[model samples]
Target: MTWKVLLPVGEATEVMDTLYPIFRLPEDGFEVVVAGPEPRLYHGVMHEIPPNENIPWDITREQPAYHVRATEAFRDIRPEEYAGLFLSGGRAPEYLRYDQDLLDITRHFFEAGKPVASVCHGVEIAAAAGCIQGRTMTTVAKCALDVTQFGGIYVDQPVVTDGNLVSARTWHDNTPFLKEFVRLLKASVAPK
Candidate 1:
């Protein structure tokens, strides 16, 4: 059977955080379905602290990057049809968390015990959905508050795996994050 993974995204999504999985998932034989607030093209952004400058920047600087097309809207997502969920990092989650449909979809993945992976600000969406309560995870240091505020345990590490959920601090942690997430996905479909 072909397994499908749901990837929710929006404008300003971190390019590496969003695009790496888009291309990597297929290599493991999972069909990636990109969803957004609307079924349209959304702009992606790159976030990084510039090296050696007159004055150091405290946080990542966002710059417009690539364009990714969302084939489905958040309201149209059928969580039951997906084998897992992947939430990408970016400023987009700051607002995407406000969407009721997206929140509901996020809850479904947790409720069903499906494999779930989140990175950076992506934790905001899961936090908003109330799925992270009592769970331990990691995200961009700046977003650690989002987890603690929502009743989840925040860890300052590259990656954290709790049950079916796998989380990472940022795009830089994608290597370990995706490794564990893919392991969870493959295990979920293993013959009982």
Candidate 2:
């Protein structure tokens, strides 16, 4: 059977974070299903620290015009039908973490012992969904506290794999994270 992976997208979704896996997964034979608060196009953003800029912007203030549309809604997802779940990063997670529907979908993956991968701000979703307790994971430094606050051990590394969950600090780490994540995913679907 073909593998299907759920990618929960949202407004202000980091462009790199959202797109890399979308393209990579399909190349590996996993169906990429884009989901969101609602089934429609959502804005994506490019996040960078302008070299000359010296001020930090609260995510809400750094909005750029990038966006990605979701082909489906979190409320409409059947988590059991997918092999894994991917939570992308950026300002989106700052708000999306509060979404009950998204939380439900997140719980589905963890509760089922499925392969789950998250990067950067994606840790917020796991924290909010209460899935991080006692789990070891990693994310962009700024989000380190979120994981620990939720009772999960936060590691600083390019990539870290704990049981069925795999994570990276940012898109720069995508290469290794995807390498490890795909391996874990394939193992999950391997013939028993």
How would you encode candidate 2's per-residue C-alpha lDDT over 81-190 as one tens digit per residue? Answer: 99999988988999999999999989999999999999999999988999989998999888899998889999999999888889899888989999888898889999
Regions of candidate 2 where Cα sits further than 4 Å from its true position: 52-65
Q: Weakest 10 consecutive residues, lDDT, candidate 1? A: 173-182
- Provide the global lDDT of candidate 1 against the true structure: 0.95
Candidates' RMSD to native = 0.7, 2.1
Task: Write down the lDDT of every candidate, Cα atoms only.
Answer: 0.95, 0.89
Candidate 1's C-alpha runs over 4 A off are none
Model 1 / residue 131 / CA error / Å: 0.8
Query: How would you encode candidate 1's per-residue C-alpha lDDT over 1-192 as one tens digit per residue?
Result: 889999998999999999999999999999999999999999999999999979999999999999989999998988999999999998989999999999999999999999999999999999999999999999999998999999999999999999989999999998888999999999998889
